[model samples]
Target: MGMEDRCLPGGKHKASPSPEGHLGTCHLYRENSCCSPDVIQDLTKANDIYWNRCGNLSSRCEDYLQQVECFYRCSPIAAQWPHPKRPTAVLAVPFCQNFCDEWYDACKEDLTCARNWLTDWHWGPEGNNCNRECISYGQMYKDGKELCETIWDDSFAVSTDPCECLTLSASDTGFSASRSRHEDSDSIEEPETPKKDSRRSGRKGLCPGSPLLHRLKKNLRKRSVFMEDVEGSGSGF
Candidate 1:
């Protein structure tokens, strides 16, 4: 399948991405999408135990969770790492360090009933039931690397590359086809550590791989707009 047409297995998604709007929280894909409006509605009120496996989740934690769900269900670029055994299913999706670290930190204290969320659930007619005791994310994994690597049964791995991976943000919408081709592999190499440095420097006026930089740029844009308005009013310095 072509890069613009890769959707998840089953009839859950459209064959190719198209325009969709009024999708509530999944509005990221309003311009182009695979998920139907109903699917996106279900996402906002989703009850897959992925977010509430423990109980009410912190907004920060759930924000990160919903990000992954949006990427998997709506983003056309996600299927680049198609599973070897299941052509329709995505696996080993490469995530950038900035995204994983922010996700892990937000949910670090949140509870979960499974280490491998893909396999630990006992699915029934209604939904999945947990077989293990719920535990905090801090207790479940050593750090962000372990959390991202283990949560989805190796469906995700962190890439050290600063601008070549997904941060699961709106800034990531520019994923390039030439940069995503991958050879099937069973194991992902360990993610390397980030060099201590400033968050200011990045290519393309933004770094899509780093959530910190993404937020920073967003604020900067807002500030620039505010200043422009101020200048138009001939305000004092």
Candidate 2:
């Protein structure tokens, strides 16, 4: 997977943003994003990640996980740090101290068996299965920094300077697109309001629901092909 603009290969992302917000779980990337509505539906069904194998997580912990999922699955900025060989993966993604701390605090009580979720798990044709002893998150990583920096290998680089970091939130659009995360910046601008187009609102009746998802899937099947971005495939985040 050679470097590409705003989208890594082997994922259900747009070659470029489709100029409209998607519905359901991935709506955070609504403003000039990559993933589509069908991708959101696909994500909702992905229940085999090792993080959940220990048991259910606290709601607060789950929200943070959702935010991380939003970034890995939907955010266009993810493309900036593409993995060396995996077109569907990213490395050294810019993240903020506040988020890491908050996420660690939220999930510190949650149980996890592996230090690295990707490799520590036992993998097979079915899905990833736990391979190690289950223990509290507090016991696995020293702190938030270690959790973020170590969990996915070199996948995320945490920033101390708050303004120069990525939030993985709706406000992320305010973050300058052209600036490299490694560069110094003193401030983060406010997100600009997107002008409403009656033509775009409601997706012209393509609202979020199973009905819309089914319709989209049906039409795509009729085409007998997948979009190039959707062709990107990998094992995990």
* Top candidate, metric lDDT: 1
Write down the RMSD of all candidates, one decimal each.
12.7, 14.6
lDDT of 2 at 160: 70
Q: List the residue pairs that clash in candidate 1.
A: none
- Local accuracy by lDDT, each model: 0.65, 0.61
C-alpha displacement of 194 in model 1, angstroms? Answer: 24
Candidate 1 local Cα displacement, residue 125, angstroms: 4.6
Q: Which digits, one per residue and each the tens of the lDDT, describe model 1 over residues 50-151?
A: 457578788888877787888878877675677888665678787877677777888888888878876888888757667888889889888888988998
Off by over 4 Å in 2: 1-5, 42-50, 175-188, 192-237
Best by TM-score: 1
lDDT string for model 2 (1-237, tens) is 312235755656677553445456566566556777766564422434645778877887776677677677666667767889676778877677776887799889998777886678788875777788888888999898999988777788887754446656544543333433433223323334234211111122222333323333343343233333344555343
